[model samples]
Target chain A: MGEFELIERFFKRPARRSPLGVGDDCALLQPAPGMQLAVSTDMLVEGRHFLSTVDPLRLGHKALAVNLSDLAACGASPLAFSLALALPAANEAWLERFSRGLLALADSHGCELVGGDTTQGPLNICITVFGEVPAGGALLRSGARAGDDIYVSGSVGDARLALEVFRGRLSVPAAVFEAARARLEQPTPRLALGMALRGIASAAIDISDGLAGDLGHVLSQSGVGARVDSVSAFGLLASPGIPVDTALDLVLSGGDDYELLFTAPPSASKAVQAAAAASATPITRIGTIHAEPGLQLVDRSGAVLMRRFTSFDHFA
Target chain B: MGEFELIERFFKRPARRSPLGVGDDCALLQPAPGMQLAVSTDMLVEGRHFLSTVDPLRLGHKALAVNLSDLAACGASPLAFSLALALPAANEAWLERFSRGLLALADSHGCELVGGDTTQGPLNICITVFGEVPAGGALLRSGARAGDDIYVSGSVGDARLALEVFRGRLSVPAAVFEAARARLEQPTPRLALGMALRGIASAAIDISDGLAGDLGHVLSQSGVGARVDSVSAFGLLASPGIPVDTALDLVLSGGDDYELLFTAPPSASKAVQAAAAASATPITRIGTIHAEPGLQLVDRSGAVLMRRFTSFDHFA
Candidate 1:
């Protein structure tokens, strides 16, 4: 079949919720009055983003999930997304499973597959997602204030622990490895939590590049300092039974958590707890923002810990 | 430097016009009141979409230009775009030139750089563009009727001619080759012509995959047919120093001509002419929509020509 026919058979879906979807040169999205459009794009290449042996369905889901994580960080409600994919060849079975995984999450989030281009090449999936938030409502990295409290939703470091297992650097029981693998392969974008925390959180970012690095972004943008409690943050690691020291390292500096790292007013701790409870996502307050302009990690006794670990750098 | 720092140093700009730009989890765009959002995406691979010898600057420009052309087909005004790029390594010189070309075109069209991801991998660029059109004013393939007149903006076939020269399949004089090469490399997305035809044109599509193939999309979507005049279309080929027979084949089915192919009611001929004149892009009347449901090419005496050439099929 031709590219058009292949898309019609596989990617094309009913444009019920969208003003227009797939088949047009450009898809139409009629935004609600006074709402602003939030956009983000992420690309995953085989061997770089995932192993060649990874499940096609999980890969497909992760492609869209990563972009949605960006939306979740901004407190935007999911609207729609476009996927640009390149394949070495047209494989029906692979596409069927992949689309099934991708569309399932999209349906759950009420995000339509708006439009995208698919071509023949080495396998690559690039997803650009569009969401909407009321004007002046989107959470920004620059909104953190000196008195804000730092929090992170969901347990951290399981994804990195999973990668370590995959690399044969660690040994784990089958069940523990499965749990960690699921964490790496099927990250949940904290959409509900983000929407719930919208007016309460002062600033937010998704933790893709570990706590230290991702929080560096918030500090640099907001022109403030942060003192993360190494004791609390390391204690929050859910690394699927990895050794304590290794788990601590992963929690502190490993990447691919896909959890919301945010700041809120110190007095809003109860409100923040309420927001997390409403979304059914657990959150832990691990630090406080400061008027100083750098990041520091503190021990349990409130003494500064000086051992530094770099964030995951794609190109260092 | 890390990927995030690389983006800040090279790709980040003032973002004066956007509601929100880089350094956020997502970029925010406020659409004009009473307007619909138009979105399109395209991905380019190194060896497939362009030659390894292509200029880095030109490659970046072509990448964004193609997505803009899709917006043009919908009669949408340029708004903003997100870029997802994967590179083998961080090369400062290459990035400087690429961003220069990409942002230069973006600035020219008033499209801002929104949000995207950068990673280390095989060189690939995918751009998703957002635009706006009034409700019910978008030009769609399904809008064409049986009795509409067909038109194309700008010249075609020169891009294919340049490809042949690049492949060493054909040779041309130095100056002639340079002119055709420019047509291949730096295609002008007929944005103004598309906007001007918003109310006048019955249907529209950008000719990325040649006249015969791309026009067939319009017919299939509209449930109509088309009969292109081989005499006029072949004559319209602006192949620099190419032989007549080669030009005929290229004009019939050569891809990568980012021109607009459109249809309009017969009575709107004057309005179509006015659009072309106002946009300063030449237009040619080369065919007619028909009740039959297939494409045909007619000779000078209106006799059907049965010869066929396939469009560039990604799978093929």
Candidate 2:
């Protein structure tokens, strides 16, 4: 099939929230009055973002889910998305499963597939997502203040554990590996939790490149330091059978964890918990923002730990 | 350098029209209260979209220009754009030149670089552009009616001539080849002309996959037919020293010509001319939309031309 037919058969859908959808030169979006549009884009490539042997369906879900995680960090409600895909070829079966997984997630979130471009090339999935956030209500990295309590939603480091196993660097039980692999392949975007924390959280970010690196952005942008309780954070590793040091590294510096890492003023701790409950997502407080200037890791006894862990860098 | 540093060095810029720009998880856009957002995405892959030896600067410009062409076709004023790029490596010199060309065109159009993703993979540049049009003012492909006059802005087919020359299929004079290559590399988007013709044009689309195929969209969407004047369209070949038949084929079915193809009523002919003059972009009357259901080509003598032309299809 040609590009047009491929789009028509796989991605085209009737206009929903959008004024115009696929098949148009441009998709027209009418954001409700008084709402600002939140936009984020992510490009996933084979062997870098995903394995070549990955199931197409999971790849599709992970592609959109990762971008939605960005919107979630901004406390935006998913609205629409455009997918620009470069496939090696138009494989009907692969497109069928991929679109099914993609549209299923989009339907669950009411994020319409508006428009995109498709061409022949090395496999790459680029999704640009649009969401809506009320004016002055978006959670941002620049909002973290000293005395804020840092929290993370869902488990962390499971994806990294799965990656380690795939790379033959580690071994785990099949059940543990399967669970971790699922987390790596299909991450749940914390849209509900993010929107619920809109007015409560001072700063927020999705943990795509490990908590240390991702939270570093918030700390740097907000001009604050952070003291993460390593013991508390280590509890977030969902997979079993790993050394404490190795597990701590995965939990703190592992990538592909789509959980939300956010902060709220200590006074708003109760409100943060309420938002977490309302969204049906668990939250764990693991750190504190400080006026000082660097990230520090602490043990259960509040003693500083001397170690360094670098985050994932594609070019490094 | 790391991905974060690379973005900071090259793509990061202070927020302009957007409430938030690069460095944010999601960029926040506050569109004018009464305006509708027009979004479009286009992905360029090496070898398929451009020659590997093409200048990085021109490649960057073309990547965003093609997407902006979609917004222009919808008669939307440029707002901001997100670029998701996958590079094989972080080459400082290439990124510098590429970003310079990309941002130059963006600045000229008053479009800000909002946010995007960067990763290590086979070279791919995906750009998602956002624009704004007054509510109910955006042009569309479904508005054309019988008896509407079809029009196209600027020249066409020069890009195909350049491609053919590059493929060693046809040869042209040095000056002609240079001009044609420029057309292929940096075709001007008709944003001004499109916005100028907003109310006057009934239906519109950007010509990327040649006139025959792109115009086919307008006809199919509007449920109408057209009688294109072959001789008149033949005049649109900006390159010289090409035979009439070959030039006609290139003009009618050449890809990568980012010109605007639209329809306006005969009653709006004067207004269309005024719009062209206002935008300082030349336009030509190529045909008339009819109630019949197929596109036809007629010669200078008004005799039907018996020629079959196929437009570019990536997967075909």
- TM-score for predicted model 2 compared with the true structure: 0.98
Candidate with the greatest TM-score versus the true structure: 2
* Candidate 1 ranges beyond 4 A from true positions: A230-241, B230-243
Pick the DockQ winner: 2
Cα error of candidate 2 at position B138, Å: 0.9
Give the Cα error of residue A301 in candidate 2, in Å. Answer: 0.9
Q: lDDT for every model?
A: 0.87, 0.90
Clashes of 2: 0
- List pairs with backbone clashes in candidate 2: none
Superposed model 2: Cα runs more than 4 Å off: A230-240, B230-240
C-alpha RMSD over true interface residues, each candidate: 1.1, 0.7
